[model samples]
Target: MNKVPMTVAGEAALRAELEQLKKVDRPRISKAIAEAREHGDLKENAEYHAARDQQSFAEGRVMDIESKLAEAQVIDVTKIPPTGRVIFGTTVDLINVETEEAVRYRIVGEDEAEVKSNRISVTSPIARALIGKEEGDTVIVRAPGGDVEFEIDQVQHI
Candidate 1:
């Protein structure tokens, strides 16, 4: 499998979730299943079915996280010397060319992309346009609305 690029923080978050699922959620679900089994009538017991469903979901998540971790190429941007170039795990500040509105974004893995937090996937159009560009460089992003231009104000390896 191809290695997936992930930031240090992103990797840490996945590890935490995996640990929780394995240590807490898995055991809790197992206990629930056992208790539901004692209630009798497995064919009609809603609690048993629900517990089984939860177990399936939790186990699937564990496998997914483990696979991702196995293929993850964790990058610690903070350890890299800042060169003003936008790269994976780097936080970038952008200024709209026309409106002069400033926005910040951190390029991260697909699993870690959250627009509300200004963390964008590396494959996103904006991040694709920004990657390899240096601060003070102008980039044109083809958004669904239209083509928008932005000026890179700053790039931080944080």
Candidate 2:
């Protein structure tokens, strides 16, 4: 199995979610299933069918999380010596070359990518363009809107 790259924080978050699924979600679904089964008439019980469906979804999610954790390569940014260059889990500050607007993004794994949190997946176009780039380097990225240029202003490990 190919290893999936993940930051320490990302791995922790996934583990936490897996724990919640196994401890809380799994038990809740199982209880619901038992309660529905107790209602009798399994052939025509809508509640039983619904509980079963929920159980399927919860179990699937738990399996997926476990698989990812098993194959993950956790990288702790704090332990990595800073190189002043962008890499996986590095937060980069950039200025739009054309508009001169400042923006920041932390390169992370695909599973942890969240625009709302300013996290971009390492495989994403923007992160690909930023990787290995040092401060003051200019890179052109193919964004969903169009091609955009950004000048690296800063790179931080945290």
TM-score of each: 0.98, 0.97
Q: Candidate 1 residues 1-158, lDDT tens each?
A: 89999998899999999999999999999999999999999999999999999999999999999999999999999888988899999999999999999999999999999999999999999999999999999999999999999999999998
Error of 2 at 91 (Å): 0.2
Using TM-score as the measure, the top candidate is: 1
| Model 2 stretches with alpha carbons more than 4 Å out | none
Go through the candidates in order and give each one's C-alpha lDDT.
0.97, 0.94
98-119 per-residue lDDT for model 2 (tens digits): 9999999999999999999999
Best by lDDT: 1
